[model samples]
Target: MNLRVRVVHCACAGGRHWYADIDDADDPQPDDPFWFVDGCATQTQALETACGELLALSDRVVRGDWLPRVLEDA
Candidate 1:
């Protein structure tokens, strides 16, 4: 698969910024991860799986974490 991964900057109201990556598994790796590709199948299949993974991850992020609050609060 030829997948693309991009890092997006997420900013908050207090001017805090965070790193967020949006990746498509079907797209070729934009960098060195190509070595792990393992000659994957068509892009369409890869993209579908990647989308599922991304959605699951987003759910976790919204749940928030205690350590995050401690650091940001300080």
Candidate 2:
């Protein structure tokens, strides 16, 4: 069960921003984390913030203290 997390970035009308998502390499239909980080002024800043958020979320998931939300329609 390999969980892969990645920081993705893009440019929008507001500015540059980044977000993170979790995926299971082994399972294709697993519950998607549907997690996203808030926008930042710079890509670097957004990525840094996203990394921290992802780490916290991942830790909680590991400890069975939290369940990732499924926000495909959100």
lDDT scores of the candidates, listed in order: 0.39, 0.61
Model 2 pairs whose backbones collide:
none
**TM-score for predicted model 1 compared with the true structure:** 0.37
Cα lDDT for residue 59, model 1? 62
In model 1, what lDDT does residue 25 have?
A: 58
Tens digit of lDDT per residue, candidate 2, span 1-31? 3556666676779776665555555756645
Error of 1 at 51 (Å): 0.2
Residue 38 of model 1, lDDT score: 19
lDDT of 1 at 70: 19
Number of colliding residue pairs in model 1: 6
RMSD of each: 15.7, 3.8
